[model samples]
Structure formats: structure tokens, C-alpha cells
Target chain A: MISAKLKERLIFIGPLIVLPGLIVAWPVLEVLWLSFRNRVQIFHIDRWVGAANYLYLFGEDLRFASAVSNTLYFTFVSVGLEFLLGLGFALYLRFSPEREWVKGMMLIPWVIPSVVSARLWQWMLHAEAGIVNYLLQSVGLTDAPIPWLSSPDLALHAAIFADVWKTTPLMVLLLYAGLLGIPENLLRAARVDRTPPFRMLFCILIPQLRPAIATAVVLRLLDAFRVFDVIYVMTGGGPANSTETLSLYAYRTYFQSLQFGYGSSVVVVQVMILAGLTAVAYRLLQGKNPAAAGDGPGEFHPRRTEVKE
Target chain B: MVPVKRKPIFRVETMARILIRSLAVLAILAGCARSGPLPDENKTVHYYQFSLPRDREAFDRLRTWFHEEHPEVNLQIHTLPTSSDDQHQFYLTHLGSRSLSRIDVFALDVIWLAEFARAGFLMPLDDLFPEREWEEFFPAPVQAATYDRHRYAAPLFVDAGVLYSRKDLLLKHGFAHPPKTWEELVKASRVILEREEDPSLNGFVWQGKQYEGLVCNLIEFLPSRNPFLTVAESPRLEVDRVRRALGFMRDLVVRFGVSPPSVFSMSEEESRQVFQNGRAVFMRNWPYAWRLAQQEGSPVKDRVWLSPLPAFAGDASGGKGALGGFLLGIHPESPAREEARAWVRFLASPRAQRVLWQDLGLTPARRTVFPDLPSRGIPLDVLRQVMESAVPRPASPLYIPISQSVQAYGSGALAGVYPIDRAIRHIESDMGRIMRVMH
Candidate 1:
């Protein structure tokens, strides 16, 4: 007969062994393993050259640098604008008389598929026969039509505009949830005490909504970091690679260049950066408590003591 | 009891039993997956053919014929999109995976054999074609199929960018014939565009899209001096000659304004629609447009005429017109390779060509088919001349990227995003970089 201790250990380790195996852990490990190798061909795989792929990406390849810069630029600008607009909409909706119907209609942009939106935007912005150009020219704003997607300078900005339209609704919903729980009595008390509109909001409202704002920012930030499909189908990282992002760069290396090893390296770098940012965000959201480290109040003050007494 | 209490001590016997059973299961799975080279009667040959809207019926009829002729050999045909670049991407992805199965016959561009063959995706057909039968094919068509002294593909169908015109419009202008040179064609097109009642109506509708179709329409002027970059021995372009040729084409849209901004959005169907509705005085397209123009309710019905694209002026020698055609290849992974070979041979034969020509209105690859059959309404001399004169694009692996870059630069210039000289220099620089990597 097996010992009880051994049986317990076996049961404990069984899930630990199989859980990660089934959840794409093995494939990820394989990519990490291959990332170290150089010049993998159809049948033969070359041996390890530590950090060569990493060096190539960071040092030699201007494309990768451009992609990183563009990705960061897009993420911050778009998310920043989205947050401001979303917060404003949420505030307006909080005070507005027609709250339910107005809020329901506001979700329309968020519900539409991104690909469909991109295609619609492409048609509206076509240089020759597009509606935007026709209107622009008709009103005597400009003599000629603007090459919105064709201009390298404006391609990324145009893509950002399309993305912001789609994602702003998400921000609105998050901020709206935060706004709903702002303790209306405290706000009334402050207003009765002659706390001006700006002062009352800054002092009483925003502090209570900190947790919700943090959550929304984290969600938007993470999503913005991995932007691919919209920019891909729209500009294809073209007009002289002005709008190239890390995801597109990785894809080109993997598919177009057929350099899986180098592509894996790029993916690993992105994962690490995202993971680091997420960890920091999570810490900030949980209030960064030192006393709570390996100890919640429940750990210190047990309910069993009351039972014993 | 004490002995029994002592654990099995990591016994090899039990461990061996578990290992053996697992191995047995794995072996069974492996065996099941292999299927051991399909049974002779069940072995099927699959071919990758491009899917164009116009060829759906023809492909179906061809499949039915192949099945009847070789009942034992099951033939599966897969259709890809008409865009050559898209189709090339599919092939590239599959080939990179080293999974050559599911394709017995690979339909490729006439210019892609050299690169594909070198890449080991194509099977050479040196011993497949007999010496005497090779002579029957038009020289240009045969030359297109041959790369580096090896036959990797067979020219299946021949297409040329013929000028499809409105015969009634020409007659009204007191010109019963199509223009013979670039200058004459320009004058005729100008007159039609200027006099047309509708402002939206165009005099010429040629492909100016940022894709392979651009090369098909624009490269006709390349033969003003020598279109092919390399001669028999050399491997470098006569750069100045090519530039001059490209200049003539650029001037057509930019300088003349004969074509429209809408041309940038057009493909084969778009161009065909423009001419078929009498909105265009002339359209440059493949032979399939002939059948479409004759269909009922077509505005240019019974008033359509086809001729080779006009040559450049001041040229005693012929102008360079692009040779457009498809090539059939056999996949190395095909189970029924032998039967697929027979099918390809039969399809390439004059008998099949005649049937394709008569039923599908497709031009045959063989020169003799045009003269040998009375039912082929095309004049024998004209067919021979087009066959002899057609200049196939450079058959390199880099052809797709190079051609795409060509379209990108040319379209950019036509759209007024860049000047002609700047665009040409950009193209030359970009192509030079790609070529260095290729070499």
C-alpha cells in the first residue's frame, strides 16, 4: 500500500505537471528555446548564439526601433485622448436627464467590429472621390484634396483617429461605473458648504473614483500596446514604413522574411515589457500596502479566537 | 508483512510496462496517420489553379474531361484568388512549411518558374516533353516555360493586352481601323474623350492599379529599344533604354490625361465594365473581354474589336508587348504523380487547346491551333504575329516583389505623389537593394 504522505504528494503534483502543459506553456517554451538558436533552416537547426537576435533587434535594425517608437507614440497619445474624452462623456452622462437611452446609444462605437470600422474609414478618406475631401474642397477650406493615408506624416495620426473612435466607448463605461459610486450625499454636503464646482469635484469626487480610473487606464494601456490588425489592413505599415508597429514588424520577420528565431526574440521583448508594466499597475491599484505583505487583517486576527472564548 | 510493507522500490518492471503501453499507442497512431502511400485506385492528384471569375465554367469542364479520361486517377483542383501576389503568398507560406501535399499540379505565373524551381517547389519536366512536340508550340510560349535550360512549367493559356475598341465609335470618326502607333492612338483617344457627351466617359481605360496588372498594361512600351533587361549573355539592364520606355508610359496618364484617376482603383473587371458599357472608347485587357463584350445588353455588343496594343513611334522594330499566361506545375508531394503528368501532357496537347479555344474563347499556347482550325475566327497571321511578338516578364523569384515595387512607384507617380524622375530613381534604388540580396 502507498503511504498517505506519498499519495498526497502525488495528487498535489499531478495537476501541476499537466496544467501548464495544456495551456500553451510548452509552445512558449519552444519559442524561447528557438530564440537562442541562429539560422534555423527547413531540416537543420543551428546551435545557440546567446543574445545575437536581441542585439540585432536593438542595435542593427532601424525598422525595429521605428516600430517601438511608433508603438509607444500611438499607445500614449491615443490612450491619453481616449481617457479625457471618455471621462468627459461619463461626467455628462452622470448629470444628464436622459441617462439610460443616451448611455445605451453611447455603446454603439464600442460594439462595432474594428475591421468594419477601418474599412468604412478607408472609403470616407479616399483621396479622389471620398466624401471628406469633397466637403473640404466645396467649402473653400483648401483648393486640393489631402492625401490622408498617402502622406507618411499623417498615416499614423489617421490610424490613431480610427482607433480612438472605436475604443473611447470602453473608457466611458469604465469611468461611468466609477462616477456612479461617488457618494452623492458627500457631494451634496460639499455643495451646501459652498464648495465650488471645480473644487468640489477635485476634493470629493476624483479620490473616490481612483480605483475605477486605474482599472480603465490599465485596460486601455494594455490594449493599445498590441495594436496590429487595424493599422495592418489600413496602411499595411507603409507610406515608407511611417506607421510601422512592433507587432507588424514581428509579423514581417516571421512570415515575409521567414526568420522565426528573430521574430521570437521580438515577441519575448514585447511580453517582458508588457508584463513589467502590468505588475506596476497592479501594485498601484492594490494601494501598495507594506503591512498587507503576506498578511491581511484576517491572518493576524483569527475568528477562531472568538469561537474559543 | 515486513517484506510486503517495503515499497516496490521504483521497480523497473512496472515502469517498463507503462512505457511499453504508451509506445504501443503512439505506434498505432503513427501507423494510422501514415496510410502507407494510398491504395493505387484511391490515389488522387490535386492541382492548385488560380480562381478568376471568367474561368469558373472552363475549369469545371476541364475537370470533368480529366475525370472521364482517367477514371482511376481522382483529380482535385483547388482555386486561389486572381491576384498573383495573393496567390504567391499562399504558395510561399505553404512551401515554407515544407508541406507539399494536397497539390499535384501547381499553377504558377510564366515569370515565376526560375525562382520556384530553384526553391525546390517545382518539378522539372525535361524528359516529360517529347522533342518533336516541343517544336509545335509557339517559340515565345515555349521560351516562357523554360528557365535555365530546364522545363519547370508548361504554358497552359496565352493572353495578350489587346486593345478592345468600340467599332461603331471608330467608324463614326471616319477611322474604321485601330491606331497603329502611340501617337495615332493618343490622337484617336483624345478626339473620343473631347467629343463624348458624358463628361465622365473616358477615351481609354487601362489598368493603372498598384499591382501586377499595371505591369501588364504599362510594359507594352518597353520594347521601343529592347524590353528584356538582359540579353543572351549579359545580366544587367540597359538602364537608359528602360527609363525612356517607362517615360513614354508615364506620359500617357500624367501628360496626356487620356486615362482617369479612377484607373488607380480598377482591375480586369473594372476595366472591362468601363469599355463594355460604352463609357470607354478603348480598353486594354485580356482575351476574355471579347466574350463579355458580345453578351446581351452589352452597350458595345457587336461593335467590339480586338487588336494588339499600339507600338511606339519612330521604331522600325516592333514594340514590346507583355506576354500574359499561366503555367501548370506538378507538386512533389502528389500521390498520383504519374497520372497528373499524363493530365498535364494531355492539356498541353493541340487537341485540348482546340477544345479550350472553341468552347472557352481562350487563346491556345500552340501557334498551329490558330491556323489549323477554321472555326477560330482570329486571322492566322495576326495570331502568329502576337505569339511571336509577346515579351514575357523576367522569370525570377524576385519578380513578385520587383513587380509590386514597380506598380507602387508607377502608381505613386500617376497619382501625382511623386515626379516621374524621382519615382524612377526611387524604384531603381529600391530594386537595386532587393537584387543585391537576391544575388
Candidate 2:
């Protein structure tokens, strides 16, 4: 015997749970199961190995350590730079007279598929014939062309640079929306009191945009941590695996090396790390912005208002 | 008022009918999608191979000929990505499922024969071909296709790395011939670089990118004993040779400065571009580069000459190049086993090989096809010599992991990122781990 309200809630929320369970949870559980077995498909070896795969990854595989470090470096640096650049761009566009036109143009980099952009960067970073080198040499910046994609010292940074270029616009879009959600009257009131621009940004705008910033940073961090296409197209984890990230390493193990169990374990560990980070990030961000957890001026419920309309 | 009250019920009935009709259509569409396109009267045999845009016409002609010969069999061609790594991944995903019987026949790299054979993906060809038929192809490719004394594939074509030199550059430097040994090559390159005084010019170029090509280059650079062979027999002896070989490769760029710093990044096409543009004095590449270099308007077209790769001084195995090329194998789970066998046999036939060579510049695996064909400005005799001395990479089911370990460590050593000794140690350990786990 269900109440009318309870039955209505079940009708609305039931599919949301079942759909994700079927599509996402099932495959994840399968991979978890696979991670515990010694499954080398090519060798026809499938047996319960328990923690051996994880042990080997942590203890014996030097590449796995490097891959973890590379992934973290790529994620933090790329996401950090993107947040800063995106915030700056979002603010500038909000105030600029040609805001719509500039915003549209800013989307070109983000709009292009990552694989295509990576290929373009690969050509532009070509040591001998690339335009970047040509410009650098012509300006007397350096006599020899920099091996952007080839040098082990510089390849990961090159990948990060590409990631930043391609993804910063997403941050801009999110932050810009966050900016728009801010009540104009608050800024008007601050201006009436003779508030300085810097103070307004630090004390008002940033505090108001905390939720957006956190969401954008976490989203980009997760995406960048699992980055494969751009780096794959550009360096292929080469010049001695300097650009190899966790996802690339896992893929190589699964597909190229045919070590399904080991690859699964690598991915499982990566997922655990991601989950921990996401939890910490959500908590820290939400702790700072209590309004995100309740109905407050900072929280914009567009859907609720639209539903009433 | 009564008619209006009944109108709502009628509308509901019509709406439900439309919904049911659309859902039935969707269900039919989904069924079609699952079983693939509508069935044809002719028996279909699916074939998968890498795309070669340049040889599309030749391939079409071969398909037409195949269809004419076997009118009952419908040959469906599917093109895999050109990269061997991608193709290998595609096969692994498709064949691992054991349900993708649509792929009746596929092209396989020589090194993948052992792995695929061991995985039970490929059908043994021992019953398909007799002793006389097997003898038609070269021994190297034949040997490469066999695992546990059972032939698993039919060699469709063969490739061997060869040295391409600028005849004009060598003559200008007062050399009668291309370098016979690695020592002579370095000396000649030094002299040529000094005499030419061209900043754009490089002494030599080869595939040094961190991939399978690097492994091939490593094999070519090693001393006559073959380090890979010694690894199984005497691991101690292999270590020193591998170190020496790797050191010399690094020295060519760092110490001699002849092979430019950029060679660390160059693959076959990039190195060929340098040599073809007359910026490189010598290049090490596969036989395919010969046709490209001799094409009209190439800067070094008339001046280029092909020769065997140089070896260490006094090494008897100086001329050996790494064996490469593709073979055709039948899927063990394929429903149309007879049709797949026919397709593989047809592709490896002498007539088919001749067409592939004449039309597509592929080096034929059949020894008989080489006798009567016009050379078309290519040095056939020199190619034959290189092919005769061609050595295959280490034959093992674990070759992919082994190759990956070699490429990673070797590239690290070449780039000065990892010390040579450390790289070697990593390689040995990685190989040991791979072999242990697989076994």
C-alpha cells in the first residue's frame, strides 16, 4: 500500500536508478571481477589470481609508477592552468562590449575534436618543418628547433599544453554561466558603495562562483587524468614513455600486451583514486559554499523555476 | 455532446495503434542491425586487410578476378586501419569474443603468427598446402608463418630493410661504392658532410621512432651473432652485444653528429623524405621506399641506389635485413571455412602475386614470380640478395610484449633519458616477467 506521493516519486526516480545500474554499473562490476583473475586472453589463461596483479603493478612494474606520476602531473597542471585562464577569459567576456562575438570565437578550439587538434599540434610542433620552429628561428629565439614532441623532458609538457588549449574553453563556458547566474543587483549595490574591482572579484564574484569553479575543475581533472587521444596521436607514450599516463599504460597492457587482468587492476586502482579525489573535492567545495546544499541566493534553481512556469 | 464524449476514446485508440506500429518498425530495424544487411543469395566470405589507397585499382582487379573464378562465393572486403598496432587491437577485440565469425580471413603480420596461433584464433594450414606448395614461397616467410612445426598462415608478400644511398654524393666524395661496413659508412659520411658544406644535409637517416621500427633498427645494428638468438642460449653474451649495439646507435647522433638529433623522432616516411629530398646522404628503409624515391620529380631520383644495410666490420652477417610483410590467415571459428581457404589460396597464387607486384609494387613471396617480371628501373638482383639474407625478429608467442619492452628501453637509451645499462636491465626484467606470466 503506497501513498500517492510515494508512488509518484517511484515513477519519476525508478528509471534513473535502473538505467545507470544496467549501463554503467554492470560493466564496472564485470571489470572488477576481471581484475581479480589472471586473464591473458591470448594465452588462454583465466584463473583467480586475487591480489597478484595489483602486487605486480605496485611492486615490480616501474612503468606503472611513472604512468601514475605522469597522469597526476598532467591532470593538476592542465586543470590548474585551465581554471586560471578560463576565469580570466570569463570575466573579460562578461564585461567586454563584443562579448557574444568573442565568446563564439573562443569556442573554436574547444569545438574541434581532440584527435584533430592533437594532429594539428603534432604538425605545428614538428622539429624540422613546423611553423612554431620557423617562427622561433626567424625571431632569433633559438638557433636549433626545439624537439617539442620528441624530447623526453618536454613531451609531457607539450601534451599538457595541447590539453590546456583544447579544454580551457569548457572552463570559460562553465564559469561564464556561473557569472551570469550572479544577481546583477549585488554588483550594482557594491558599485553604489564605491567597491573596487579587485575587491569585488575576490570578496564577491569568486565566492559566488565557487561551485562552478569546483565543478569545472573536478570535471576537467577527471577527463585529463584519463586522457588518451591527444597524447596517443601526438607522441604515443614515446620518446621513452615520458608522456605515458595511466589510461595509456592500461590500454597498452590490455590491447597491446594482452594482459587483461593486469590492465583491469590498473584501471580499478585508477578508479579508486579518482573516487577518493572526487569525494575530497566535493566535500571541500561544498564546505566552503553551504548555499550549494540549501536554497540560498548563490544557488540558481533554473529547473525549479521553469517547472513552476 | 455524446459524440464529443466518445471522440476522446477514439483518439486514444488511434494513438495507441500508431505507437504500436512505430515500435514494431523499430524492432524490425534493430533485428536487421543485429544480423547485418539483408541476406543475399550468394554465399558471402568476409575478408579484412589494411587499406592501400595507391593500390585500390589493383585490389579491385584482384577482387573482380576472384569473383569471376568463384561465382558462387561473394567476397566482402573490409579495410582495417593501416597501423599494425591498431589492426592488432582490432583483431584482438574481434577474435577474443569467439563470436565474430563474419571475419573469415584476415591479413596478419609475420610476428603475430605465433601469438594468434597459440591463442587458437587461426586455423592450421598443414592440411591446406602440401610440401611442394609450401616450397613455392621463400624460406624466411615460410619459417615465420610456422608455429610448433604447423603452418598457420600463407605468406602473401615479403619485405626487407635495405640501404638507399645517393650515388652522386658517393661519387663526389671519391668513393667507388656504398659503404660495405658500419666503420666505412661513418668515415664516408664524415668526409661527405665536410666536403658538401650544406647545413641542410645529413649523413644518414633511418627509422628510430619508439615503435616496431626501432626494434628492427636495433636488430640491424647488433653484431653478427644476433643478440635475440643469444638471449635464449647465453643471456650473458647477449647483454654486451646489445649494449654495444645500443651505444653505437646513440653515438651516431651524439658523438658523430652525422645522423642529426632529429633522427630520434623519424620513422620510415620521415627518413625517406630527408633522403628523397637530397638532404640525406644515405637512408635505411624497406623496399617500398625504392619506388617512392624513383618517382618523377624526386630530388634524388636518378642519383639513388639501393644496397644491403652495412654491418660491423668483418661480420659475416653484414647484409642481413629484418624480415617484414603480411600473411593471410583463416579464422578458426569462421563458418565459411572452405570459402576462406579458397580466398587465402587465391591471394597467394603465382598469378595473384605477379599482379600485386606489377600493379602495387609489393615484393612477391613466390620465388617463381621474380624470374620473368620487368624490373621497371628497380634493381631486382640487389633486392633478391637482400631478401635472401633477411632475418626474422625473435619468434615467440610473447613477441608483442618483448617488442614493447625493447622499444621502450631502446628509445630511452637513444634519447639519453635512461642510461644504457639501466635500460638493458629493465628490458631483461620486463622480458623475464612477461615470459613467466604467460607460461
Docking class of 2: acceptable
Q: Each candidate: what lDDT?
A: 0.72, 0.85
Which residue pairs in candidate 1 collide?
A: none
- Give fnat, all candidates: 0.02, 0.59
DockQ of each: 0.08, 0.40
In the range A138-251, model 2's lDDT, one tens digit per residue, is 999999789998888899999999989999999999998888777666666788898999999998899888888889988887898889999999999988889888899889
What does each candidate score in C-alpha RMSD? 11.1, 6.8
> Which lDDT tens digits does candidate 2 get at residues B272-295?
888888899999999988888989
User: Which pairs clash inside model 2?
Assistant: none
| TM-score (all chains, Cα) for each model | 0.72, 0.88
Candidate 1 displacement at residue B128 in angstroms: 2.3
